[model samples]
Target: MNETIGAAAAGPSDIAAAAGRLTRAAASGVPCAPVRDLIGRDDLAAAYAVQAALTATRLAAGARITGRKIGLTSEAVQRQLGVDQPDFGVLFEDMAYADGAVIPAGRVLQPRAEAEIAFVLGSDLADGPLDARQVRDAVEYGVAALEICGSRIAGWDISFGDTVADNASAGAYVLGTERRTLEEFEPVDVVMSMSIGGQEVSTGTGAACLGDPIEAVVWLARTARDLGEPLRAGQVVLSGALGPMRPVTAGDTVTATLSGLGTVTAGFTEGAAS
Candidate 1:
């Protein structure tokens, strides 16, 4: 969370090339080679630059930014990526699915599922200390969520910069219907159990998410502000995964239960994306 925000050392051409590679991958449903060669493996700023360029393209195509998603909250994942802090990605309105919905398998290449806590903000976070208290106060409500993660990079082999440039490897998400206020339960204390095809595949607690999901938001709010894109009112934030992520494929059903929050399910179907 102590990471700084600044312009990437890579020039505009490299940034554009990285973005173009990811854009084609998403558009054609074919993963591309890692973009680290263009943006540099350890350059967070440069990677984010590629993400920003893609975001601009999406906005130009009339895509709406519904929220933001945090990634690499798991210490184990951090170790795999060789990073100490989490990264974030934009969440588009089109990426959202209701609870118990059937998701198309073709929507994402090499999809994976993980449980998470989703917060809908009631107030703007542009100006504040962005502490845990402020994050809790800003929330309109909380819900159980399933993050369907994917990578535009081939073989899912990526560096910190590659994943960041690919929008934290975001694909889609499902939000549960049940909602609760912060007063109803503690986010850091929530227990999670996730199952696929009637078998439990992942388990963890709220503490798994950057110590607490609120702490993740605090990190995001500050980072987003520093990057000139502060969070706004009514934005949905997927704090991060509460447990290990399991690979999901066609016809797989994923159910996740979050204590004090509620249960959410996502059914995957084979065929073209809808």
Candidate 2:
């Protein structure tokens, strides 16, 4: 019989160092070496561990945890990243903005925007696997949302490990004012359109997001619970992007409108508080 071998696990110091590198890159607004280069590539568990540690570092620095964001739920993004499943990251209070707010371009490195449906939970989701219906029932309402994703990995050269260690490449997010209850909204049938400077760039339906945006939320709830952090009530959940992400540069104004949900806008400026 032949014996099977597994990849070596990363120790505490390795995880801490990798997390520190990511923290430095994010704070400096400069890209750094991929985490896989510092730690080995095959240890996804270690990469997530680094992500947790990185979140802790931010929390210690006065950042408050707002909610979570799901990534790679779209088949296009999954294919782009060469992954078959989804990944998630923590969202911070400082990362949120109201509709039509101008985002500080200087704070983000290599920014891009994606349209998504945002769910605000009415009840706490505890540990265990949840179906899409179960996930949908818990939602208080859904709103139009735009996620600003930024990569700390140089030139966006990222593997799964690199992205996971970089907080799912999340930078900031904005939510529109329109809110509709589950009874009035069909999570799987909603259509979305995104435009930059009044030029249509991408279009997709709610089905593009892991079959339905509700399914993405369910996956996040279960995945977070398994990771020892359950989804809580009042936390905003970005279900995932409906279409391909579009590059965002300084002075760019991006808008996304959903079928039932109203439109949301985000403007980027060259400096802070534009």
Candidate 3:
């Protein structure tokens, strides 16, 4: 009944306008219809192009690209989304927080939390096919991370194209202080447990993220390269969720602890913008 980004359909040529509408909704903390519905195109390539256009708009508005995030890497999450491969999104400098920071609930729409393994790159990864070992070798260290995801699409009803165009639904992220070098970490076997209000809510292992988190990084590297945007040195890469994502409410405290990688926490407060 309402005309929102996802409520109405647009032609394939409406990519730019669709991106603009989504960007405005995100900035205003409002949810809209899925871009896929608005654009009338489910093409992943076009979706990514829209994401790039949105990122450019942000950059033009004084935002800087700090890193990237990999999403939908878990088999369970993939199965839920009906997608067989992972997707990537750009991370902005303003979207980062240190462990134990208090986050305003009004900043995001329908936020959810997921535990992650964050890789800080030591050297630039060129665009090309890479293996897990190559991905690991470029890492400066691995730290426990929490990806706070929020959807700009109304009701979180989205297709793969919708999320891709929504910048992988990335909201904010917090990284632990205890960073371990590759020699000190075995990512594939690390265990992660998340808790809210002092009660355990979700648990998972590194293997749950594309068999090994490094593989996600590798996939991202290749994919970004193909998209003509290679991941760079000094950039932090969120290697997907280690477990199912849990909803966040105002006044809730969420904590994620990763074996050998340490812990990260986020506090949500009331009075969100929307």
Candidate 4:
């Protein structure tokens, strides 16, 4: 598995070293290549392995695993990335901010926003080949979530591998006002709508997420287990998006209205204060 990643000029060590550099940049507000150089490798498995390692380092360093995020799920985003599928990543607890929390957007490199449905896990999920039933059983609540997508990519040329390693471009997330119980809302039939700056931008139904979000959660958990980072209890998983991702800038306010759950809003740091 690693030999494939070694095909890159940087090799495994170089790729691993780049991870440290990435952490430093993210912490110190400096900038560097965002796993794109590693993505140039011809082997898909290798690139993904590098991402797993990068994510593992954060976990080992005490980063709390909160939930999972699935990107490129929308057909439009799939076309933009030149892929017909979605990529996934883990969201850390510290990365979650309550709605209305002032996000110092300056720290982000080209931050954007996307509203998504967030699933709160009630129990640890370590099952292999996990099914939608398991996901449903493990989830205790659902809420509207807003994912703030920040990327180190100067241009929008990032590939699936690059996005994957960058944690699906996840920087921060916002939880909405209400928590809906599974019994209250049949997640499979819930509708969702997203608006940016008061203008509707993305919309779809809960069914858009691979029939039901629980299915996406099942896939994420089983897949993460295959990668060696099984889902943990209390993690907030942002299922796939209901629609395409829109570009957001400073001062932009965004909200996602989830039928069963409610709404969550996050405002980008205003220019002078951004």
Clashes of 2: 0
**TM-score, predicted candidate 1 vs. hidden true structure:** 0.99
- Candidate 2 on 1-274: residue-level lDDT in tens? 0112233388888888888888888777778989887666646677788888888877888989989999988787777777778889999998999999998887678899999999999988884446767787789999999999999888888887788888899989999999999998898999999999999998999999999888888878877877778899899999999998999999899999999999999999888432
Candidate 4 residue pairs in backbone clash: 66-235, 66-236, 67-236
lDDT of 4 by residue, 90-186 (tens): 7777777898776767746667777678888898789644776777888888888888777755554477767766667777788987988788888
User: Model 3: per-residue lDDT, tens digit, 170-274?
Assistant: 999999999899899899999999999899999999999999988888888887766668889999999999999999999899999999998999999988643
Alpha-carbon deviation at 218 in model 2, angstroms = 1.0
lDDT of 1 by residue, 56-144 (tens): 99999999999999999999999998989999999999999999999999888889999999999999999979888898899999999
Per-prediction CA RMSD (Å): 0.8, 3.7, 5.2, 3.7
Error of 3 at 81 (Å): 2.4
Better model by TM-score: candidate 2 vs candidate 4: 2
Residue 120's lDDT in candidate 1: 96
TM per candidate comes to 0.99, 0.94, 0.93, 0.85
Q: For model 2, give the 10-residue run with minimal summed lDDT.
A: 1-10
Candidate 1 least-lDDT 10 residues: 1-10
- Kindly report which residue stretches of model 2 are placed more than 4 angstroms away from their true locations once superposed: 1-8, 127-129, 272-274
